[model samples]
Target: MHGRQQPAGHRFRRSLTAAAAAGALLLTAAPALAGDGGGRGGGAGGGWVDRQLSRMSLEEKVGQLFVTYAYGETADTTDPDDVARNRQWLGVDNGREAVEEYHLGGVVYFAWSDNLREPRQVAGLSNGLQEAALDGDGARVPLLISTDQEHGVVSRLGPPATQFPGNMALGASGRAADARKAARIAGRELRAVGVNQNYAPVADVNVNPANPVIGVRSFSGDPHLAAELTAAQVEGYQSGRAGVAATAKHFPGHGDTDVDSHTDLPVIHHTLEEWREIDAPPFREAVRADVGAIMTAHIQFPELDPTGAPATLSEPIMTGLLREELGYDGVVVTDSLSMAGVRETYPDAEVPVRALRAGVDLLLMPPDLPTAYDAVLDAVTTGELTEERIDRSVRRVLELKHDQGIVARPFADVDEVAERVGPPRHLTAAQRISDRTTTLVKNDDGLLPLADDGGSVLVTGWGASTTARLAERIDARAGSATAHWAGGDPTPEAVDRAVAAAEGHDAVVVTTSGAATAPGQARLVRALLATGKPVVTVAVGRPYDIAHYPQATTHLATYSYGAVALESATRVLFGEVAPRGTLPVMIPTADDPGEPLYPFGHGLGYRR
Candidate 1:
């Protein structure tokens, strides 16, 4: 209903009989439809896409627009656990059964869903899923396997995958090169596991200090800095060698909101003029960089659409602004339909139909695939959505698959996955990125670089794992160390134990995550400051903790609690590495809301 309607009979739907036979030889004999220009009429692969489109049933074409989630390591797993999970989530015995039953176009992997366990296992799972998809009864197209390998806190595959401090760390480092290198390593590792699409490089500009979800995930508070880093990341992810499709996500920006869209819809009250100045720059830069995909946010901009619909179901935002005004002909995907943000306005079945009608090419993680898929098919049959409209979306998807080399070579060698993923060199690069992001915001007391003289240090913080890791790293450099995992918003007994423990150590390093909201962390830091020993505050989550702890003179912001980041913070503390990162977001003064405790770009060097 929203896109330019083509004539009803542009490409008549044919039966699946001949198409199934052609699909059998698709891997070996099909024409290589690999190249750029994924717009309608299909850039370089136009001829191949048109021929394939002519032979597809309407049901198969509709299935290509969905990218659903499933649970399994392999498609044909006989394991009871795998079968139970597959049955619970997809009403199938295994992933192969799900693919055939739903006629699925793609599948997304999540660690909790048991889709990703290790590099080799993930590669095998990907190959198995592809086999099921390309079978005669299935959709007979290469699946676009995707995952949220955003590193930092959002990482799915653990251990063997190289970990780096996330986007805000890169923003604090203030180097586009670091952003590119981080993304390049991530892309290579993801592609090695047969994930062709990465839903990452969150392009939101975090201007509001109180933002809940997009806090450390966003690159920077400054628009220009965010734009620069976003474009670099896009290029890095889509580098010819990696060939993974990079998605610039949460379009029209999810930065300024105080609400999390996962729980409910967030309304952003920026006018069109304000949107252009604030939120549009990063997306514009991403588009200019030729990003492979752009994901719509679930938030609403009343100024952009007076109808008050969120971007995912609004034609003015997705089609008019993104397509016509911005000239982005690339794929436009919706944020997960399973989220509450997109579900509040419509029924489960209608969400996908509305999203497609609003010009969305891919519907991600619909809560019920059968209901959503059948609703889409029914829309076409009822003339609510024409087949021509469906063709346009399917063409874009196929074109993207062709351009990203997924159609031609969709499998990864299980033997090579281990060699390619998380090698020593990639981990070293990740550590380097982390080292540069350790920002020395306040060193007024000059208690840092504590002589490296075998003095005992106390490392206390939120999560037990992070605190223990920091203690180990510091102990290796310093003489001895003690670790106390004072849980988030520590209790009085916990804080008392930590403060009593700090008395025995020469100096204390207290890491606070989300200290702005967690007053107990501020209480713990203040109590440690009362001990009269050198108390160094480390903000490992949001840098805004400094605003809450104006009295703590020796402070640092690592922007992440990731192992690599904790290691980098320890190195900075011991003068092994200089704290080179500047403040990407201004830490507002606690006393005066308008004033800054540490202004943007403020940091200290070790002077070594």
Candidate 2:
């Protein structure tokens, strides 16, 4: 999703279109000479843009720069007996009073909302909130509706919207086309519900395996691959044909921290030069791609801002580094202010003002809306934050809306959005990509493609049900298959149960969930391997997990347990898909001998 602005590629395309349109118009009528005294037409256009800005009260303009979470009022007041009470917990509550009273610029919808099952429902809810944002006055601009629909684990639109593998899966697939396809699918879904902005295509490269929040969300550990995927996602989201803008997120980089910013502030110890070389490449590539917005991470880079303030409140990080050094003229939005990283550090009201002073256009989800609004308004009155800064941000925000066609065409038919979102064609595309992307990491002792006649099979792990589904599909193709399932700690007992069940069968399949770092998984895999049965271990997560089961007769790294990835694993196990996917990262060895368990781009072909 384009952060704070439209995608760069989309902007370029629009510019080209505008240029062509102007040229065609010039052909019909003689073009006026440059500097031929400001013509009536030019004056009228300038006056219109200026009048729109000038007519806005100081409050409205400042409001336009503040985006807060919309948890519906009805949600909070819903009776415990109400059927929709559970749905209310998903972050859609009536913040209409805040929007109307404060002239809030926009509202972000969280995936947890109960009202988002279908596109039409989403459309209705969006329209209602947007209408409320206008407050029955034609003066206030329509609200900017946004969501984080990055697919897989981050999807907001459920059911009808097909979910693709997360970025880590895309990285494992080693196909930029797959990333582009996922972006296109995601874009279609977002636009279907009147959601114009997506905080997605996480640009963070998961260089640190211990990164808690950005693990599977990141595309790859390789900066170059992450850049390529980021560009692809940006292109796909703003293909403009889909009418949605994608934002490349968690800027400067969120993939190296062990801390989750949602819970605590993370510190980046890198120097400016190191960051420029390693951490900043994907963001720069996104900026070069002209991403509409950049979402600032809550990380504190003491080297850049020694005060230990999060990037959201650091002028050097936001303006000096992002705007001046990187030359990103697009909108710069802060990540949720509700996150502990910022909330715990700064005073309630001071956070938003500090962010505005740091050149942040959008203050996202401040804990208290009225407090933030009053604080920013007071800052402007006190000359702490100039009205000029407010104007700058408002203009960019307006321009984005205009560019995304949100201003000109405020509402779209709910049916149309429904039709476009998760269409059969897009789902088919996701399935095809998943089928081709599932990787087979190891097949020693030729244990894969188990005989159809193989009697009973044992399936156990964190995501065993998903893995079992794939195994069932493969088993169907092979022969009549019986499978037993067990969840949690693949322990000696767990493996023993599976082994006992598979005693009369030809092979046993053990699936491990979570990352490879979980201790119980390793013990279970070793126990299963010791059973002397043909062990096929499928890692429905990161390739690093496979280090735990090096002795397994066969190993597959599906990268994720998403529905699509599971289906892809089925195809690979059945020798249907080519299993062309490779390891996108170096899987470390258990012995800590320093040699990688599996090298990048390592995959085994059936024939080989």
Best by lDDT: 1
Tens digits of per-residue lDDT for model 2 on 110-164?
Answer: 6554446577777777777766765576356877788887766676776677788
Q: Score residue 75 of candidate 1 by CA lDDT.
A: 68
Top candidate on TM-score is 1
lDDT of 1 by residue, 272-361 (tens): 656666788899999999888899999987667767788898877777667765778788898999999899998999999888877789
lDDT of the candidates, in the order given: 0.82, 0.70
| Candidate 1 weakest ten by summed lDDT | 1-10
Off by over 4 Å in 1: 1-41, 137-139, 591-593
Instruction: Tell me the lDDT of model 2 at 94.
Output: 50
* Global CA lDDT computed for model 1: 0.82
Error of 1 at 152 (Å): 0.9
The positional error of residue 310 in candidate 1, measured at the CA in angstroms, is 1.4
